[model samples]
Target: MADGAPAAAATDETALRRDLAAAYRLIALEGMDDGIYTHISARLPEGPDGQKRFLLNPFGLRFDEVTASSLVTVDESGAVIDDPHGAGVNAAGFTIHSAVHMARHDAACVLHTHTVAGVAVSSVEEGLLPLNQWSAQFHGQLAYHDYEGIALDLGERERLIADLGAKNVMILRNHGMLTCGRSVAEAVKLTLNLERSCQAQIGALGMGLTPRPLSDEIAAHTAAQYQKGYDRIEVDGRPDPEWAALLRRLETAAPGYDA
Candidate 1:
């Protein structure tokens, strides 16, 4: 039983590491990454004491280079737990992810990005407008936080958490975007949809005509339908069909992420 316990722990850790690494690779494939700067973090399954530990990418590695073994483990304070390579955690990652994981117990994974489309939408005075189906999915659920410089200051953590509130997705004003979910699949899916919404709004604005906004009542109804049916099959924190297909895509493009 003692020997089996160690094996079980290793299996759980490997599964989470692979899921997180796959997220990074898929983000890179979708051109949503900001070189080696952006981060995706996952909280470890709780132990007997119930203290949480998180997994973060090594500071210097590109998203394509991330693998199950290359990930570094850290505590709630962002201190490396058993990092053999001496790779340090990113300050921005620590500040943003740590703040959310501490505040929102439901968030098991947090993804942050700075893509051209995302930042372009974020810079606009009117934030994300409901110009299409993708935009309507967010509707009233998306939060917004004003960029407070580089996010290195400890003081910004509280403000960021307050701005995020109970929403799963947020647009960092003049910065970029962020999303959290009960699983990596959920977080990645939200990021993909948010990015598409931002891209569509940009294209609509390019037409030089004032884009029509959806009525609040209509938007609310659409969001409710999506939450009830479109997001069905959220069993075990993993959505079927889409998430299964995404993992297959990752296998073909970046097969060694779990290695």
Candidate 2:
């Protein structure tokens, strides 16, 4: 058994790599990825030195092709501490993720996307509407921030954090949508729900018929339920078993994510 320890460690590393790779593939399959623009990041486990860092996708890689090994570890300053691919990290990616992570400790995993429906809804003056169950889930939980060009300015972090406030989901007005969660699974799920809501809303609007809006009471109730689901673990610091299962599923589907 002693001789097998190294092999076991290697196996564990491979599993993590495959799981992360699968996440990227799943994101692409859901149509939430926008070329090479969006990013998803998770904080690394505490290191030997008791330092906490994060893992992010390389700057130019497509979401579908991102693997766990391809993820670059960076400090709070956005400086890459470990990157095997040698692909320089994007400054804007660092600006956005760093600000949110620093300001909100609850946000262990951050997912940002620029889908067609998401960008379209962001451009609308009314913002997200409580037209159905999906939108209703975000009734009182969504925040909006005005656009200020590409997110390359570190100075914008203050305003971004200010607008985000305590909300988990944010619409970057005229830009895109962002979701943060206590873990990568929750963040990914939030983004998926947000995208689905936007797609459904846009489809409803294009029909040219007056869409029915949910009653305030119903909407509030639905939003409460959704919050409860996220809060069940986020606030309690408990690991989500469902998220672990998801990683395993991804491993089966795309075996190189963590590589």
Candidate 3:
């Protein structure tokens, strides 16, 4: 046992740290990060003391500075349980992520971001339009939560959860974007698709040409195919080939994320 942790638990924690760190680095590489703000968190498969805790980037480190060893562990309440650098978590981050983690047991990882494209679509009244293939992926799978200030109060957690019921992606009205998944890779993939969809919508809207949307039948069919990982090669039921290629790219461009 490592540090009194069972062998299985220790292994799971190690993998989570490396994967979460890699996610942060990938997001930074894509220019989706907003300095030290925004967060990507993974729930520990087995937390210390047998309680539910998650791994998040330390509050002070930039995304590029985050590493597997530097990630902090916090309970569902967002209280720090283990932080090698003695750093705290952002309060607003805690409020938002904790609500999802507590409400959705299947959500092993949660990714949130603030990008120009994302915020632009979020502020609009109609939300994400099914104007492109990327947008179609979220046809019936996305939800929206009206913004309620800066998300500092614990009282707002219920509303946040309520608004996000059974949905994997959410637009935080006037705020940004949020996505959760059963793994770090899945969460990151969702973030990438959502961000790209928002960017495409913004661009389409900018052209002043009325963008034609996919019909409801086609959109729903496309969404179903996407859920099945259609039109792409897969390994072990995930887009492993693409994910592996991404990791190779990350290894050259931004090394040591898994340190």
Query: How well does each candidate superpose onto the true structure, as a TM-score?
Result: 0.92, 0.86, 0.93
User: Candidate 2, after superposition: displacement of residue 207 in Å?
Assistant: 0.8
lDDT of 1 by residue, 1-259 (tens): 5769978998888888988998999999999998877899999976557867899999988898888888888888888876744678675667889999999988989999999999999998899988888999899989999988988888999999999999999999999999998788889988999999999999999999987989998888877876765356554333468878999998899899888
Best by TM-score: 3
lDDT against the true structure, per candidate, is: 0.87, 0.81, 0.87
TM-score, cand. 3: 0.93
Worst lDDT run of 10 residues, candidate 2, spans 12-21
- Residue-pair clashes per candidate: 0, 9, 0
Q: Residue 240 error for model 2, in Å? A: 5.2
Clashes of 3: 0
When summed lDDT is taken over every stretch of 10 residues in candidate 1, the lowest stretch is 230-239
Ranking by TM-score: 3, 1, 2
Candidate 3 lDDT score relative to the true structure: 0.87
Question: For residues 120-201, could you state the per-residue lDDT of candidate 3 as single tens digits?
Answer: 9999999999998999999999899998898888999999999999988999999999998877888888899999999999
